[model samples]
Target: MELFAYYRSTSSYRVRIALALKGLDALVVPINLLSGEHRQPAYRAINPQGRVPALRTDEGSVLIQSPAIIEYLEECYPAVPLLSQSLVTRAHERAVAALVACDIHPLHNVSVLNQLRQLGQDEEQVAQWIGHWITQGLAAIEQLIGDSDYCFGSEPGLADVYLIPQLYAAERFNVSLAAYPRIARVAALAEQHPAFIKAHPANQPDTPT
Candidate 1:
């Protein structure tokens, strides 16, 4: 398997965590998003959406979107399940993942922030925009998650996989996690977990010095 990813992209980070948790090895194909590599025709051929985290499977099939690739990973690699077997618990886990994936992350995505800049929003305004959405989303997640070592349970599952990357993004944008103690605890736990450590943006092949 090959994973085309931008080291700093939260979406890519999520997928990397999932793969590592499953003990899967995939060649990391670095796509320099800052250098506009993702916008080139070569990457567009892999994912017309031109986004990072496209997975090319061993069978020679390419899967686009972090959600779809992750779902595929979950289905294909069931030994280390990222979700619970109970239907209700699975739904809850997915909900937490969606809060970050669908609700919070997109609003502050590079494309969205670029659009805001084009619309005359200054850097301060963009920073404020990132802070507001991340704080709101994380505050809700803090309430939703239980008092455990990881999000929703003692084991790192789907929610942890999603949450850790968002926390990284939060730190990157200077959004404080001090207000969310449960979230902070999860982050603290993840800091020591081998999978999380291996998947960290700082540890990625494309990470800048």
Candidate 2:
């Protein structure tokens, strides 16, 4: 398998964490988003959406979108299940993941931030936009998650896969996690998890010095 990804992209980061947790090895094909590599025709061919985190499987099938790719990974590699057996628990885990992936992350995505700047929003305004959404989403997640080591449970699962990258994005945007202690606790626990460590943006092949 080959993963075409941008090191700093939170979506890519989520997929990397999922892959690591599954103990799967895929060659990292660095796509420099900053350099506009993802917009090029070459990458567009892989994913017409022209985004990072496109996974080319061993069978020569390409998977796009982090959420879809993650679902595929969960189905294909069921040994290390990301979701729980109970339907209710699985729904709860997916809800937290969606709160990060669908609600929070999109607002502060590179494209959205660029659009904000184009619409006459200054850097300070852009920062505020990112902070506002992230804080609101995380605050809700903090209340939704249990007092477990990980979100919803002791083991790192779907929620942890999504939350950790969002936390990284929060730190990048200078959003304080101090207000969300449960979220902070999960982040602290993830720091010691080998899968999270291995999948961290700082440890990626394309990470800048």
lDDT of 1 by residue, 1-209 (tens): 99999999999999999999999999999999999999999999999999988999999999988989999999999999999888998999999999999999999999999999999999999999999999999999999998978987889999999999999999999999999999989999999999999999999998888
List candidate 2 stretches off by more than 4 Å.
none
TM-score of each: 0.99, 0.99
Question: Against the correct fold, how does model 1 do in TM-score?
Answer: 0.99
Q: What is the C-alpha lDDT of each candidate?
A: 0.95, 0.95
Error of 2 at 3 (Å): 0.7
Model 1 regions lying over 4 Å from their true place: none
Q: Cα miss at 167, model 1 (Å)?
A: 0.5
Per-residue lDDT over 41-158 for candidate 2, one digit per residue giving the tens place of the 0 to 100 score:
9999999999989999999999999999999999999999999888999999999999999999999999999999999999999999999999999999998999988998889999
Clashes of each: 0, 0
